[model samples]
Target: MEKTLVLIKPDAFEAHHVGDIIKMYEGIGLRIAAMKLLQMDERLASIHYAEHIGRPYYEPLVSFMTSGPIVAMVLMGEDAIHRVRELHGKTNPAEAADGTIRKLYATDGRKNAVHASDSPESANREIHIFFNETEIYD
Candidate 1:
């Protein structure tokens, strides 16, 4: 099974949508291999979003991420990365499809409800960032 990382952002966590989000993924047959709630510090955020460092949205994104606690989970299933990203929908809620997580819970593009690894490489990299082998389960 492929493993991907999903982040229930601060906005969604604070809005009490974490249960609904997890249910949605579970309903789609994704299994949670590992999970945790954490408050991302600046260093972590910087490391997580290193590619976006010079972009205009970088600073705001980091600030928002560090503003509250977030749930980071490792979900395992066939095509997990693609599946998670599809469910997450477009970054802008206004542009997301109906029934998608972002469409249902995001306040805006910047505060989109969740973040998922976009590819196998990203998934592997991100999963390691949040969890070690001992933390995952079959």
Candidate 2:
């Protein structure tokens, strides 16, 4: 089985939609191996989004992420990385499919309601960033 990192962003938490979001993932047969609610720190957010460091939205992205508590989780399943991203839909809600999580809950690109690691390497890296090995129990 593959593993992926999933983040239910602050907006979801603030809006009280965490249960509904988690239910959507569970409905897809994704197993939650580890999870937590955390208020992201600037340093951690910077490291997590290192590739976007030079992008114009980098600063704002980081600030937005740290603005409230977020739900971080590690999901395990077959083709988990790609599967979770598909479940989240496109980065921009306006372009996401009608049935996608973002399309249903997100208001825009910058305030997209969720994040999923794009690859196995990124999944592993992001999983470690938020969870210890033991935390991801079978």
Candidate 3:
């Protein structure tokens, strides 16, 4: 089965939508293999967003992510990475589809309510960054 990393960002947590979001994923048949709620430190934020390090919105984006507790999870299923992204909708809420998570909860690009790994390699890396070997189950 394919595995993917999913982050229910601080915005969603603050809005009390974590359960709703998890339910949505479960409704779609994706298994929640592992999960945790934690506040991200600056160092972890930097590592998680390493690729966007030098971008204009990088610092603010990191700050937003670290602002509150977030739900980090590993979802397993066929094409999990792609499936989760589709469920999340586009990166920008303004452009997201009507029924997508982002469209329903996100206010903008920077405040987009969730994050999902875009590829298998990223999924592996992100899943490791947040979860240990025993956290994930088949």
Candidate 4:
């Protein structure tokens, strides 16, 4: 099975949508291989969003992410990365397709309800950012 990282962001958690979000993934056949509730720090945010470091949205992104607790999870299934991204929908709620997670819960581009790694390489990198090897269950 392929493994990918998914983050149910602070907005979703604060709004008490964790169960609903997890249900969405479960309903689609993905298994939760690892999970945690974490309060991110600036250093970790910078590491995770390193590619966006110099961009205009970087600082605010970090600030918002660190503003509250988030749920980090590893989802495993065939084509896990693509499946989760499909469920997550667009980065902007306004453009996300109907019935998608972001379309249903997000308020703006940055406040989009979920995050998923875009590729196998990124998934591996992102998963490690939030979890150690022993934390994952196959």
TM-score versus the correct structure, for each prediction: 0.98, 0.97, 0.97, 0.98
The C-alpha stretches of model 1 lying farther than 4 A from their native spots are none
Residue 110 local lDDT, model 4: 90
Model 2, span 1-138: residue lDDT tens: 998999999888888889999999999999999999999999999889999998999999998999999999999988888888898999899999988899988988978899998888888899999999989976
Compose the digit string of candidate 4's lDDT tens values, residues 48-93.
Answer: 9999999998999999999899999999999999999999899999
After superposition, the stretches of candidate 2 with alpha carbons farther than 4 Å from their true spots are: none
> Model 1 misses residue 57 by how many Å?
1.1
Clashing pairs in 4: none
Instruction: Estimate the TM-score for candidate 2.
Output: 0.97
lDDT of 2: 0.91
Q: In model 2, which residue pairs have backbone atoms overlapping below 3 Å?
A: none
- On residues 1-138, what C-alpha lDDT tens digit does candidate 3 reach at each position? 999999999999999999999999998999999999899999999999998899998988888988999999999999898889999999899999988999999988878889999999999999999999998997
Q: In order, how many clashes per candidate?
A: 0, 0, 0, 0
Alpha-carbon runs more than 4 Å astray in model 3: none
